[model samples]
Target: MSKKEVETTGHSWDGIEELNNPLPRWWLLVWYACILWGIAYTVAMPAWPGIKSATAGVLGWSTRAEVAEKIASFEEMNAAVNAELAAADVTMIKPGSDVHSYGVNMGAAVFRANCSQCHGSGAAGNFGYPNLLDNDWLWGGTIDEVAYTIQHGVRNETDEARYSEMPKFGADELLTDEEIDQAVAFAMSLSDPEGDGTNLVGGTYDVELAAAGAEVFEYNCASCHGEDGTGDIYQGAPDLTDAIWLYGGDHDTVYDTVFNARFGVMPAWGQRLTQAEVNAAALYVHQLGGGQ
Candidate 1:
């Protein structure tokens, strides 16, 4: 048979004729394959959106289900370690042991998921939040003490919560502004003696003002904070001499702390975390440089 001539559809742009060509067989086949694939995918997997949920396709597979299975597996894997941690005494756990290491690792994960929101990812706290890495602890820094604090929390509604309330000297009219200022000055003298003393002989404080402030402090703050300002752990009174301030250590910060007072609240974790988790977190925190 003679070769057939290709025909033009009679459409022209700038005197250039366009050929009436059918799509290539391979391209047509590929396009059809795509259409079939789309239909198959819609039937075999979740595709259509519904008011509440997507359509559960024939495979019955779901991403949420997969994630749940993964979590269950993880829990199962850690079950033995968690059991050991819960049974062992927090103080008895030997440092550098496998169990201790596991607890620390698990504790870090738990801290990241739960505690990090308030304490920060690095456990370095902000203005109100207490720094976990520091030596200054309002409650106590021992492993058992830390565990107890984690379990019971601080100033929470829970009965076992470590509770203390500093009197609002300014807000409640317990102390005049002058007295509060004097107290602030005295507190600063305790921490920054060099700056607050009159001369090189007397350290950094104004001896007379500090003396007056001392009288005010003795009358109001000494019961909980101690005469030397060393702080009493049982009362949750922070040490004023060390210069580690939860709110701040400056004069203004001291004035605010004395006048308004600070009431930091930590939620009771006993209800939220497992006993093992609480112990593990305590161990992890204890090993973080400042743990007594």
Candidate 2:
């Protein structure tokens, strides 16, 4: 437009007039549309905050409610199968059956969510955690036993929890350092009768120490660990005769175990997971070739 037609805001900077140029009509219309949409959105969905909670919008729509609806639908779909699983005896759930298939898949899901933190994703286990795929069970390996352990857990506050405590022979002064040394030597020798008192990782000890340790083990550890060092499942004592060491079978590790003792805790899944979930987890673990 010509300078004569242009209206100025009655201000000048260095003799340049300040033109009162309004924004584009379309731009102003879009801006007004955005403000209206925002107000509508606030009214139609959960938005404004209050003292105790957010305001429930006019539409009463919420993300949490949507999630709850989805969960309810899924639970309704699986209710029948889950009820059957919860009621069924885990031992009698034969392989390749419908319930067995459901249980295995469900158990795998449960194990991934609950057990995989300590036990590996593949149930291989970590240091101080028992491997679920192995036959070397500190507790019994039966399906029923696995279910019970999952329900009550080990070393937990639950009254029915599996409980056991090994003496800190060296740390507590229940045994002399020499006696502990002997006991460690004997424990190592249990797994390797022909070799010198060697740990699983090839750390060596005096085989001579084992002979004296035999008496020490018999007098002190035999009651819980068994006379032959095979371990007692009732007491949750680990088998010294096996290469499957939860806390490592190395010489120093063995000495540490003998000195301070090892105490590993598994959570009572029954308190967390549903009964059907616990049952499925037990069933899946039982058929993994480790269960007795």
Q: For every model in order, what is the number of clashing pairs?
A: 7, 0
What lDDT is reached at residue 200 by model 2?
59
lDDT of 2 by residue, 99-215 (tens): 999999999999898889888898988887888888888679999999999999999888989999888888899999899999888888888866655655566788899888999
Estimate candidate 1's RMSD in Å.
Answer: 3.4
RMSD of 2: 3.2
Tell me model 2's lDDT, rounded to 2 decimals: 0.88
Worst 10 residues of 2 by lDDT: 193-202
Q: Which stretches of candidate 2 lie over 4 Å from their true place?
A: 1-22, 49-52
What TM-score does structure 2 among the candidates reach?
Answer: 0.87
The per-residue C-alpha lDDT of model 2 at residue 129 equals 84
